[model samples]
Target: MRPALYWIRRDLRLADNPALHAAARAGRPVIPVYIHAPAEAGDWAPGSASNWWLHHSLQALADALAARGLPLIVREGESLATIVELIAETGAEAVHWNRLYEPARIEHDTRVKQRLKAEGIDAHSHNAALLHEPWTIQTGTGGDYKAFTPFWRACRRQAEPAPPLSVPTDLAAPDGARDLAGAVVPPAGITAPLDALDLLPRVDWAEGLRRTWQPGEQGAQDRLGGFMETALADYREGREQPAVAGTSRLSPHLHHGEISPRQIWQAVQTQLARHGAEGDRLDSAEMFLSEIGWREFAQHVLYHHPEFPDAPLNPRFADFPWQEDPGDQLLGAWQRGETGIPLVDAGMRELYTTGWMHNRVRMVVGSFLVKNLRLPWQAGEAWFWETLVDADLASNSLGWQWVAGSGADAAPYFRVFNPIRQGERFDADGAYIAQWLPALAGLPAKHRQAPWQAPASVLGDAGVTLGVHYPHPLVDLKESRQAALAAFEQIKKGA
Candidate 1:
């Protein structure tokens, strides 16, 4: 029997991989292939941080496949062309892949599948990334859901997602297949080695990323295990505290498909069963799952409204007056963590160093960008795309739009976050702030949050200068909030 080619994309792992599972179960030898075609993703290509994660994740995937006696063929080219060449070289009878919901990917995959089918090859695409496919859930009137609560409720009304698939124990290599492990040049359609993908930075700037994350299936499982044991108990309250490790840091892993939502769902369910679902445990489990639900909602929204990444769901935002930053001075400060707002700066610095940010701080910084700074949300979105390891298109777009108050079920435009208050509420002791903004470490807890408000004596005692040690506030918070509200009023009036 001819072997089947499993085209790996975002779904990188072996265990719980629907495409790999189906290909393995076909009773024929399987050939796994990864095609690196960043341009195919269009403007939303994986950024530096994501690329760093990808480099290591692919290495991990390759090693795992080698352990199973199969070589993960790495190639750099147009995805369809690479797949076709691999099929011709290996004489594969079918192509199987997991689905991706990004508009560009969905369109490209559809075309690839149709073209393959026309050539008489079996083309199979399976749901491996999402708990429920976007089309599977709809409102009472048979339309896509615009709000998260009802969408989640509708999802819960459906049968529970099936348990995750186990890693196939019977992965057989095709006849004449050579183990291309560490091969500088492999024959038969292998164009470049993993290094040739150039998914790492030219400069060695990812040291912090290396320290913060382990980018593979094993690492993902380890994170989940750690979250369950250490944080699940107090997730509800703890997730709110930026200084606490209360939430699962499985985002980058999930974005890279090192772990599947179903796997997380199963893990959470197992915890509930083991500890008995009651009180805090149940609430925490439910709250955590709702986050996963939000991820689903974001993807579904992207699927139904393909313009989500670039345009607002609410048309009124099209004419909303966004402040002009002539030289990106405002944006540059925010990006560099020199915004002079401790909470916002800490979040930006954390993202720069770790390729991840605490959720609460993310909202705070996002609000500061779109509201307090009155800059275009897309500017912030683009920065995040280039920086965050978990820079998922769906989530990134939804998040920015949500903060801008121009998305479906978005926060009201009037709700501008006060960075000082946010810091006091979430990072009261300034632990999160100090960790990222060490220059402000000497300040009192209250002063750390808003050094501009500190007395001259307090500033002197802390060895801090307003502009030299920590930059002065870029914009007055109260004045900016009023300005943002006035601008919002214009959009509200369709001016």
Candidate 2:
């Protein structure tokens, strides 16, 4: 049998990886290769946290594959060039990979497959990233779904569970194959290098992230088991309280393809089935599943449109007037988590400090940056790209646009989130804020949200000086809302 190559991109796991399984099943020698695609070859590539996590995750993957007596060959530079040359060097008759849907990746993968076909080698791809391949969902009239309700309904109807694939027990590399020494790309965009993201925590407090998140098939299983044991039960309440453990926090795992949506979806389903849908546990499971639905919808849009990252699905807002200038003070404040709005600043700091933020706060801060500041959504997107560890093209684009009211079935243009109210409601008693923003840690619950409004004596009493320790609100909420409403009027009028 001719040797086969499994090119691992986003789907890093041995289990439930279509490419890995197919390559193993080829009844021939299988050499699995992970090509760290040259998206950010120089200074323009991956973020601090993503790079940090990638390093650790890849290490875990290598250890796991090594344990199973397999070698995950690493390659750098143009993926197609590497894979094609790889096929030639190894005398491989077939190349198998899980598909990716980003526009740039689509173009690259298409060219790779076309070239492989010309050379008489089989290049097969599978839908391993999403639970339902984006192409599969459609409307009653055979059109792509423009709204999430219809898209999600179509997804739920598939009903057949996405069962996990068993790990391959053994594999062999190509004979005398020394053409590849496993080079890596630089941390995106920069020409000269630092090291692989599979390496460090770009920041601190990551001992928990490091401890909680291990990035491989086995690690994903362990995380899932632990969630089922303790946290999955309180996910609903936890999701609401940023101070507590509520969400799966497995987004980065899914983003890195360290785990599959199949694993997560099935895990949630199994847990829910065991519980009879009566209380917070079941409600939380349902909510988390819906979050997955959003992920599905993002892919569905990306699959159909293919131009999502650069363009908006809702075109009316495409050319909407946005202020662009040399300096963005508001943008600066927002990015640094110094906006002085307790909730907004806290969320930004969380993102900067931890490379992750509570989802509710993600919405609030995103809205403040884009709408309240009358800034471009892409600006926020760019900042998010650099900052978030869980920043996925599909999920991040969908989320940024949704927050900006420029995505399909998005939050209405008029429904600007009141950050204060959101914090007060979801984070009642101000515990979440205090946990993240320790300057306000000493404030009584009632005064935490609007600390600046409290008397100067209150600041003195807490040993927190307002202007010295923290800035006051950059813009008054009431005035900012009026300005945003005005901008919305113009956007609605012409956009």
Full-model lDDT for every candidate: 0.90, 0.76
Measured against the true structure, the TM-scores of the candidates, in listed sequence, are: 0.97, 0.90
- Give lDDT for model 2: 0.76
Give the alpha carbon lDDT tens digit for every residue of 1-495 in model 1.
889999999888999998998898856789888888999997788999999999999888888877776777777779888788778877998899999999999899999999999988999999999988999998888899999999999999999989999989888877554332433323233322578777899999999999999999999999999999999978999999988888999999999999999999999999999999999889989999999999999998999999999998998999989999999999999999999999999999999999999989999999999998999989999999999999999999999999999997788889999999889988999999889999999998888999999999999999999999999999999999999999998889642
- For candidate 2, the clash count comes to 19
Query: Model 2 Cα displacement at 83 (Å)?
Result: 1.7
**Once model 2 is optimally superposed onto the true structure by TM-score, how far is the C-alpha of residue 253 displaced, in angstroms?**
0.6
TM-score of 1: 0.97
Candidate 1 Cα outliers beyond 4 Å, as residue runs: 177-192
Which is the leading candidate under lDDT?
1
Worst-scoring 10-residue span by lDDT in model 1: 183-192
